[model samples]
Target: MKPKCGIVYNGHLQSDKFMVQLHWLSDTAKRHGFEPELIGNHRLIPAVIDGRCTLLGPYADYRPDFFFFWDKDIRLARHLEKMGFRLFNSASSIEICDDKSRTYEVLAEHGVTMPKTVTGPLLYEGFELEDVSSVPSIVAELGLPLVLKEAYGSFGEQVYLIASEEELIGRLKSLGAKPYVLQELVASSYGRDVRINVVGGEAAAAMLRRSETDFRANVTAGGRMFPYEPTDEEKAFAVRCAELVGADFAGVDLLFGPDGEPVLCEINSNAHFKNIFDCTGVDLAEAMFRYIRSVLYAADGSRKGDAPC
Candidate 1:
């Protein structure tokens, strides 16, 4: 009997992009001899963790052979993990990678090159911006054209490039005390960066992102994709980032620092692959499915209840 697999996503199936990826994942699972099912918000998703009315609905009250949280968010993954679901990428990894500042900290701790970062408290909590007296020193250290980002933001939504002190203060005031991070801007990567998809601690594919009009290079924000070949150093860094966060699959973004070294910018636990797939013929969904299946098979054989072959 084929193992039952659930592909979960937070968006509605009506979304074209989401549907495409879901189909790809389902197809890959079926090809690998698994009973793959696409479970979205409108339908019931088995093996889900209870108490969350997410796009995948509530848990089906029974354990599945395999549960894929897809891009449904880290919180759901954490809840499911607590409910005894075998997740491909654990909730801890998702949570760490989802926050840019945390991702930076993890990479830096592992000796990976990354921009200097300082996280601030939330604006709504009455955290005074005046408390950050070292702003000037930080600017002096990192120089002009620094990047400011919210703690939890995606798709280039909450990123800013402040070139002057006035601009920095104005932007901070506008943020209204929301938690944020300041980092040295990699001017060379102005609207450009490399995104590498790693599976099982190996670089599966890479693509260069370029946005001529915006400082953010997210494809969803009008960035163009170009095929990129990862250098030995880049490959090593990608692997390290994935392993550091304990991600079974990940998208590692790398930018060039002022010293011309490849530095980790961020890692995505549930990275979208259509852009990279369009640029490079790497089918990430298929690769991920194969890796997950291999792991499940190995784990099954290791269980005490399993018969010795």
Candidate 2:
């Protein structure tokens, strides 16, 4: 019998954007001899009864061999893991990558080349930020035109570039108690970056994102993507980043330095591969499915051989 895999997604976010991912992943899983099932978090409830946490829902009676976690629901992911479901990216990896401050801390410990960063202090909901002293110090350290990124955000939505002291202070005050990070802006990579998709410790596909109008190189931010050939060093950097984050598959964004060096930007465990496919004609879902099958069946004496390309 084929191994059953559950693809967990946020049912509340019923946008077509996320649904497309599910369709691709499920189709790929079927081609690779795995039974794929879709389970929306909205439809399921996680309950802790008698000191044991487990899921209760329409599909609660059925447990898959493993899970393909595609959502950022850390609590639900952890609950599933507690129930002995092996998540592809793992709950721990998702938690770290979902928070920029945590991701930076982990990568820094691994000696990754990243921009200088300072994590923002968390504050209570009703608390006022009266300590304006750190504002000047942060500006002085990172210089003007620095980037302010929320600890947990995607699609470059919560990132801001402050060009002046007034803008920086105003933005900080507006942010309230939200957790964020201040980082030195890479002038050399100002509207452009490369996103490399890595699976099972190897770089699968790469594309260069460019935004002429916006500083953010995210395709959602009106950036255009172009097929790009990555150098050996760039490929290695992306692969190492995936391994460091303990991700079975990941999209590693790299910023170019003044001397054309690859500088770590961010890692997305549940990276959307539509843009890369449109630009590079490579469907990373296939690579991801193959990687999953290889690892899942390697030690079970049930290897199904190579998946069709």
Candidate 3:
């Protein structure tokens, strides 16, 4: 019997890029002899909770063998995992990766080399100088032209380069101090970084994201993507970062520190693959399916072995 796969994606198929990813996954599944079902955003929650059922829009309900969370939204993963769905990159991993502050903590715990960073409440909400005093210390230790970021931001949004103390304080006050992270900026980056895609504990592909005009190097932020091959040390660092967070698959961003060492920047659980696929010709969705199949098959075999025969 062909295994049924359910892919949970934002229902807005209006974007040509999103539609292309969906088509690629569907085609790959068909080629692999699996029944492919695309579950839009509306029906995703109920379908996962109901188990082995299908849902039509907001009404129908269905369960699937495996659930693929395609969006950066972390809440979906949390809800589905609670309902006992087999999910890639698990909910806890998603939550940790989604919050920049938490990501730093986890990476640090694993003894990964990363930029000197300070994470706390948003600037607008008002942080006590005493409570967040370490932020200034990091600045003084690492030197000026630092990066200030929101705890939950994507596509290079809400990230700022602070060149002076006034600019740093002003930006913090403007943001209302909700929750943010301040880090030592890597000036040599020239608004560029390496994004490595890892699956099943291996590095699939890597690309250099460069934006000479802006401080952010996200492709959507007017950056360019070029093929990149990480050195052995770089590759090992990327893989270890992903493993530290327990992600089934991940996109690890790395930057060069002052000492010219590869430092962890951030990790994305539900990484965008359109740009990566365009640059590397690696069909991640297909690779993901194959990996999932292997895991499920192994588990089934283990169950049979344990059964009283």
Candidate 4:
């Protein structure tokens, strides 16, 4: 019998690309000799009952050998781990990648080449900074114009360009204690960046994103995409980032430095692959399914003989 993979995804996410990717993932699992089931996050309610932990709700009688976690429900992911189920892009890695501050904190210690950054203070109801209006040391270090990104946001909606001290204060006041980061704007990569999809510790595919009217070059934000060929240095850097994050597969964004060197932007644990597939004609889903199969079998062979996941 083939192993079962519960592809857990967010049902509330309503998007064409989201649905398409899920379909592709399911199809690829079948092609790779696995039984795939689409399990929404709502179905897997983590709970403890009768002195034991278990998944309840509409999960039915379907038990998975391992899970392909596509949702960002960290608690549920951890619960699944407690049950000894193997998950691609493990829960801790997802948590770090989900929050910008955590991602920077983990990578910064390793001397990754990224923008100069400062994580925002903890949020409280009446918290206020003393010198946001004076270009204080924080602003002084990051400069007059910098990038203020909310720690938790996607699709470039919460990222802002603070061009003046007043704008910084006003934006902070509006933010009202939400966690954020202050980063020195890498002017050289304005409205442009590269997205490299790394699978099984290799750069599988890449694309260049550019925008004519917006500083943020996200495809959902109206950016144009073109096939990109990363240099050997760029490919190696991206693979290193994915390994550092402990992701089986990930999308690594790179910003161009002043001298055109690649700078680490951020890592996406659950990066949307449809855009990359469309631009590069490379199917990350296929690569990912195949890669995980090998990993699961290799472990089984080395440990308990003939076991399957």
TM of each candidate vs. truth:
0.86, 0.95, 0.84, 0.93
Report the error of model 4 at residue 90, Å: 0.5
Q: Candidate 4 clashing pairs?
A: none
What local lDDT does model 1 show for residue 205?
98
lDDT by residue for model 4 (1-309), tens: 887899999979868878989999999999987899998888888888797768777883557878999989999899888877888879998998999999999887786899999887776778766545434778889986899999988877799999987888888878887899989999999999999999999999999999999888899898999999999999999999998888999999999999989999889999999988889899999999978887777645342344443
lDDT tens digits by residue: candidate 2, 178-225: 999999999999999999999999999999999999999999999999
Q: What does each candidate score in C-alpha RMSD?
A: 4.1, 3.2, 4.4, 2.4
Number of the top-ranking candidate, with TM-score as the measure: 2
Worst 10 residues of 3 by lDDT: 300-309
Tens-place lDDT per residue, model 1, 159-257, is: 888889778887887777577889888887788899999998789999999999998899888999999998998899889889999899999999976
lDDT of 3 by residue, 70-149 (tens): 66556666666665667776878888898999999888867798878877654433444434355566668767888898
Give candidate 3 misplaced runs (Cα > 4 Å): 45-61, 122-138, 298-309
Ranking by lDDT: 2, 4, 1, 3
Candidate closer to the true structure by lDDT (higher is better), 1 or 4:
4
Clashing pairs in 2: none
Give the distance in Å from residue 236's predicted Cα in candidate 2 to where it truly belongs.
0.8
CA lDDT scores, all candidates in order = 0.78, 0.89, 0.77, 0.87
Candidate achieving higher TM-score, 1 or 4 = 4
